[model samples]
Target: MERDLSRQELTAETLVLWEKTRMSLRNCIKRVMRSHGVEDHKVWGTVHAYAFEIVKLLGTIDALIDHVTKGSSTREMHPWVRNPLRVATYEMKWRDLKPAIATSEAVRIISERVGDGPARFANAVLYDVEEVTLEEVLEKAEDEIERLSIEYSHPTWYVKHLLDLLGRDELIELMKANNEEPVRYLRVNAHLKDPDAVILALEREGVVVEEDPHVPLILRVVEWNVPPVRTEPYRRGWVTYQDKASAAAAYALAPEPGERVLDACSAPGNKAAYVYAYTCGEVELTCVDINPRRIEEMKRNFKRWGVEAEVVRADAARLKGVLNGGFDAALVDPPCSSSGSYNRTPEAKWTVKWRHVRRYAEGQLRILRGVADLKPGRMVYSTCSVTVPENEDVVHRFLSHEDTYSTRKPDVPVGSPGFDRWMDRRYRHHRHMIRLWPHRHMTEGFCVTLLEGG
Candidate 1:
C-alpha cells in the first residue's frame, strides 16, 4: 500500500482525478484515499469539503487563473499545475487562508508530484491571484449571462437556461442554494427495523433527524456529530441515506404487495430498495441497467437493505428480448444530465452541456418506450433533472408516439406541477407531472410523472 498523504495533497490528487476522469467527487476521493491506504473519516471529510467547494467554484477560480496568467486559460495548464492552483486559490479566496500559507502548500504538493519548475510557476500564479478580487473578474464579463455564469460557477448555457425558466430573482436564489452544502435525509428501513426504534437509535448515536410530514418514512437530517454512515442505525441497516424527493418517487410509484414491478435503468438501486421496504419485500421486482459496476453496487445495496430482485445487466432502452415483460407497474427513472442534483454533485454544473441534455432526452424516451412495450399498467417516469427536455418534452414525445399511454397525476403531493409548455408546443398532460426545486422544496431538483396506460 502507498503511504498516506496530507489532506491538502489528497485534495489536489482527487481534483486532478476528477478533472481527468470526469468522475463524481465522491468516487474520485474514495479512489485516491484508498490508493494511499488512508481511512480516517476526519481527513476524508476535510478533503471532501475542500475538493467539492473548489470544484463548485471552479468557473470563478479558473477565471482568476486566466486573469493572472494574462488570458492563458486553465485548460492550457497541466492537471498537476491546474488542480493545485485551484485548491490554493479556493483556500485564499473562499476559506480566507493567507496567500503565503496556501501558496506554500500548493507549491510543495506540485513540486513533489511534478517538479520544481511547475511548482514555481504555480507559486507565481497564486501570488498574482491573491491581489485579484472576484468582483474584478465578474465586472470583466461581457454580459449578464456570462456574469452569472462566472459568479455562480455554472456553465454559460445553463445560466441562460435557468434564467429563462426561472426569472432573475428565483434563478439567483436557486444558484445560491446550489452552492450551499446539500441537505441530507435518512429513510427508515421499516421492513428490517422498527421505525420508532430506528429513530431512537439514530438520536442516541447523535444524528439529529426530524420526520418529513408528507412522507413518513423519510427523515430530514438536522445535524450530526458522526456521519450517518458511521452511525449504528445505518450499520444495522435501519436507515439509508436518500433524498426526500427521491423517496417520493417510490411512493409515487406505490408498488403494492405481490405486484410485478420493473425498475428501468436502476443502479445503486435506491428506488428499488425503497419499493421493497415499502411493500415489505412482497413485491416481485426486476431491476435493469447497462453498467456492470453499478449493477454490482446495486447488488451490494440490496444485500445491505435486504432487498430481493431480478438484477439484469442490459441496456434499458433495448430490453425487448432479454427479459419477460408484463410488469404490473414500472419505474422508468432514466439516466439524465442530473441538473437537479448540481447542489449535491456540484461537478455536474461544469460537466453537463446542452447537447448532453438533448442526448439524455432521446435516451429517456427510448427507455420509456421499451418499458411501455412491456405492457405495464402504470409507470412512473422520474429523473434528478429539472430540465424540460429530459422531463416534460420526453414524456410528451413518448405519449405522442405511444398512444396507449397517458399521464396521471402522481400521488406525491409535495412538489409543484411540471411545465405545460416548451418552446412552441404545449404538453396537455404536464399538469399531472411533479417537479421538486432545491430552492423551494428543500430537496434535489427532481421531476416525477405518473402514467397509466396499456
Candidate 2:
C-alpha cells in the first residue's frame, strides 16, 4: 500500500519545483508570450492543483512573515527556508491543517535544502505563524488598504490605488471579485453556425451554458461535464473561449462588411478572432505583433478560429517605416498592466507593482499613436485593465496630444462610465468611456475607449 503524502510534504515539494520552473507574472503582456510547458509533467500537474492555494498564500505571505519573525524583517531569512514556511503558514491558517504538521514539514524541507540553523528559525516562526488567521489579521487591520489587501489577496498598492476612484464598499466589492474564480466565456462562431444550434450542441455535450443577453455571440459556461476545450464545438471551431469584455470590444468596434480592420498588438488573438466572428468573416484584417514568435502564435490562433487575417510582424510602438497607415478602423488592443485580468491570472496579482501601471500606460499610448495611422476613422483603444494610468489616464493624455482625434463613445453601451476625476487627472468625456466591473458583469474587468477622427 502506498502512503498518502501529507499536504505539507506536497506543498514543500511544490515550492521547490515552483522556484525552479515558474514563469514571471510581473506583468500580463510578457507572460502570454513565453511558452510555459514544463518538462517535468509530474511537477506541472501537482503545481497547477495548488494554484489557488498558492494565491491564497500570496495575499497573506507578508503578514505571516511579519508575525512569524516577531515583527522583524523576513529579508533576514534565506529564501529556501522562508518559502516553505510561507506555504506551511498558508496550510495551517487557511486549509485547516494542524500547526505541528505544517511546522514539522517546513522544518524538514528547510533542514534538507538550507541548514539546521535556518530550519530551527523556520520552526519557531511557523509556530507563531499558526497563531495568525486571516480573520484575526483582518480584525486588527490598521486601515482600509491593509484590510482589502489581506481580504482580497491582492497587493496593498493595488487596493490603495482603487480607493480614490471607488468608495469603501465599491473597492471591497471589486477586490472580492478579483479574488474569486472567473467564469469561462466562449464566443459562438456566428460565421460557422447559428447561436441556438451552438448552445444546443454545447448542452448536449453536458456543458451548461448561458448566452449573454447584451452580446448575442457570447456564452457563459455554468457547468461542464468535460472541459470546454475538449467539447466538439471548440474542436470544430464553432465556438472559441473568449472573455465577454473582449467580445464587447468587437461589438464596440463594429467593423462593417468589407471594412479594413487592423488588430494591433493581436498576439494570443482573442480580440482579433472576435473581429472576424462579429464581422461574420466579411472584414479584411491585418493582425500585427512586434515579436516573430507572437506573429506565429497569432497565425495559429487565426487558423484555430477559422479567422482570416493578414498576419504581419510589425512593432506597434513604431509602425511608420514598416507599413503605411491607411487603416479604416484599427482595433488597438495595446499592452497594459492587465490590472483587470489579475483575478484570473493570480500570479500577476503578486508580481504587479504600482510602477508597472505608468510604464504600461506609456507603452499603450505610444502604440496608440503609431496605430493612429493617416486614414483613421474610428479606433478602439482597449485594455484588460481598470487602472487609471493604463485606461482613462492614457486616453486622457492621448486625446490632449492628438488634435485630429476626439473621444467617441463605443456603441453597445451597458456599463459604468469612466471617472471624471481619478487621483489627479480629470477626463473631459469621462462619461463617454465605459468601465466594466467584474463584480457587476461577471466578466473580466475591461476599459474600452474609442477615438474618432474629426
Candidate 3:
C-alpha cells in the first residue's frame, strides 16, 4: 500500500479544513443571531478550539435547535436554513459528530452559501436530523414549564419564572449553574499592582491565581494555561478582567478621597474603573452616560484603568438639566434584566424577557428617582440582576419614593440577603441588600443596594 494512500490523502485534507472551520462557525452564529438579537458567544473568545466548542453548546445549542426542528418555528427556518441547521445540530448532538459527518457538513454549507434549493432544504432537514439520538430527540414540550424549557435550553418564560423564584431545589441548582463553563475572576491591580507582585507575575504566565477570602484585591482564575487575556499580568496593569461580584461593587462603594462620586450608568467604566482604582486616583469621579458612544467608552475605560474620571454624557435617567446638585457618593449601575448575568451572558437568557424585566425595572426606577438630586451621602444600587422584578422590586420602589433614602448594610465580605419574600413585598431593609449568588458565590448574579442621603 503506498503508505495507505498517503494516509488517505492527509485525512481528506483534514476534512477540508474541518469543513471550512465548521462553516465559519455557522456564519458566525448567523451573523450574531441576525444582528444582535443574541447568540454572541463573545465571538468564541479567541478560538480556544472554538471556545471549547462554543461554550459547550451552552443552553444546549438552543436545545439542539428544538430537537432538530421537530417542534418547528425557528421562526420558520431560513438564515440559510436556520444557521445551517444550527451547525448541523451542534455537530450531531453535542459534537459526537458523524451523523454522516454532520449531514455531509450541512450539505456542504448549503451547497456553498445557499443554492440548489437551499441545498434541498438543508438536505431535507439534515435528513431528519440524522435519525435522532441525543436521548432520542425529545421536546414536544407543552407543560411542566414547557418541559423545563426543552429540558434546560431555557426561556420557557425563563423556566416559568425560575419555577416561581427557585423552588424546585434551587431551580435545579440554578439550572445546573447555568450550564457550567464559567469561573475566571481577577482584579488585583491593587491600586496599580503588587498583590505579591501580582501573584508572581501571574505564575510566570501560566496563570494560577486564587486569593479571595472575601473579595479584596481579588483573584480566582484558579487554573489556566493561558488566556487571562493572554497574560503578562494582563499587560502591566497588574490585572483587571473583573467580576468578583464586580469587584465587590468596588469594595462596597467605599469611594472616599475627596468624594463627589456619581457613576450612574457609566458605560464601559467597570464600576467607574473600580472607583478610581479603589480611591487611589482619589475619587471626584463623574462618568454618567446616555451614550455619546458610551461617553467614548467611558473615556476608554478611564484610560485603561489608570482611572481619573469625569466623562459625563447626561440622562442618568433624566438628571434634571444634565446634573448640577453636588454629590459625595453615588454609583447606580442601572440597566437590568441581566438575570444575574445569565451565567456569563448566556445570550442574556434568550434576550431577557418579562417585557424586558418590566422595562428594566422601569428604567431602574427612573435612575433611582433621578439620582436623588445628588443629595447623595452615598448610594450604590447595583444589578447584574437575579431578578426580584429586577432586584428587590427596584430596591423597594426606590425606598418607597425616597423618604430621603435609607437602607445600608454592605460591609462586603460576600453576600446573599435581599429577597426577603419579594412579590407581595416584605422587606424590612431586606437585610440591607447584597445578593450575589451564581449558585452561591461562584458569583455573577449580583445586586447591591446601600443608600443613605439624609
Candidate 4:
C-alpha cells in the first residue's frame, strides 16, 4: 500500500512545484514562440494557468522584474529576470510575509541552482526591501505607468487599461482588491440541501463563511480548507465549487426541472453540473465540447456530483446533426482571451499582446452566430472575459445579423451593468448582462448574456 502524504509534506512539495512552474511559465512563452511554429490558445492557456498559480504564491511578476533590474546585487541577478529569487523578493516586499522569512525561503529553495554567491546576493538585497506607503511610492515615480504598477502591484498595461475604463481612484481600489488573496466561493447544491442549511453545516464544521448579496448559494470562505466536494454531503451530490457570477449564468437560464437543455462548450463541466444541481437532476442535460479529454472531465464531474448528463466530444459549432430544435435552452460559454481574469490569472497579462483581444472577439462572434441559429428557446451566451469586444460586441453582432433573436436579461440579483456607450456603443443593452470583476465582485471577470429566439 502507498502511504498518503501528510499536509506538511504536501505543502512543502507544492511550494517547490510553484517555484519551478513559475520559471517554466516565463521561459515557455518565449521558447514556444521562437522554437515552435505555433503560439496559439492552448500554449498560452496552459502558460496562463502556471502563471496564475505562481502569482498566487509570489504576487505580480512585474514587481519581481522591477526589483531585479534595480536591486543593488546586479551582478548576481538572474540574466532572464524570471527566476525564483526575483519572485521571492516580490512576495517578501508586497505579499504578507516577513522579509527575512521570505528571503530565507527563496535562498533555501534556489541556492543550489543559483549558486552560493547569487543566493547570498539575493538574501542581502531582499533584506533591504522595506514597506512603503503607496503615496510615498507614487510620489517617487515620475512615470504614470510605473507609479500605478508599483502602487497597485499590477502590470503597467493592466493599470493603464483599468485607469481608462474605471478612472484613477477606482483603479486604485480595484488593484488593491486584486492583490489580496482571492476568496473561495461556492454554489450550494440545492438538490441535497438549501443554501442556508449548507451554510449552517459549514459553520458547524468550523468554517468561517459569508453570503454575498450578488449571488444565490454563493458562500465566500473567510477560513477553512475543507474540500466540500470530497465531504459526504458533497459525495451525496450536495455542494460544488462554483463562483457567484458563474452560478448566475445558469440561474439566468433558469433551467426548470425536466427541461431539455444543451450545454455547448461544456468542458470541465462546472456550469453543466450546476445546472443539474440547480434543477436537482430533473433536467435532461446534454453537455458538449471539442476536446475528448474535457469530455472525460465533464464525465468525472458528473460522476462526482452523482448527476447524469449526456457528455459528447464534438464541436459545439457543428452540433447540427445531434438535435434539430430539440432543446428548450442552451449555454454557450465560448473560448475567450480572458483579459478580465488578469487579477486571478496574472500570467494572461504577459501573454496577451494587443492583437489577442481583437482576435478573441472575432472568434467569439463566429461562435455566437453559429449557436444562435440552434437555440430552441432562450439561450445564455457567456464567457470569462470582461472585455467589451468579446462580451458585448459579439452579442451585438449576433443580434444584428439574426434579427429574430432578442436580448433576454438574466434575473440575477446583483452585479454592475455592462460598460457604458462611450466605452462600446454596441453593448447598449448590456446593462442586463452580469459583469463580475475581481476589483468589484471579488471574482474573475465573467459576462453572461441571455438571448431569446426560436
Q: List the residue pairs that clash in candidate 1.
A: none
Compared with the true structure, the alpha-carbon lDDT of candidate 4 equals 0.66
In candidate 3, what are the lDDT values of residues 153-195, reduced to their tens digit? 6677767776786777787677678667668787765678768
Candidate 2: clashing residue pairs, number: 0
Find the 10 residues in a row with the least total lDDT in model 2.
Answer: 26-35
Runs in model 2 deviating more than 4 A are 1-46, 71-76, 135-143
Residue 406, candidate 4: Cα error in Å is 1.3
**Clashes per candidate (backbone, < 3 Å):** 0, 0, 1, 1
Per-candidate Cα RMSD to the true structure, in Å, reads 1.5, 4.0, 18.1, 7.5
CA error at residue 239 for candidate 2, angstroms = 2.3
Deviation from native of the Cα of residue 160 in model 2, angstroms: 1.9
lDDT of each: 0.88, 0.76, 0.69, 0.66
**Best lDDT goes to which candidate?**
1
Estimate candidate 2's RMSD in Å. 4.0
Q: Flag the better candidate by TM-score, 1 or 3.
A: 1
Q: Positional deviation of 332 in candidate 3, in angstroms? A: 11
TM-score of each: 0.97, 0.88, 0.35, 0.78
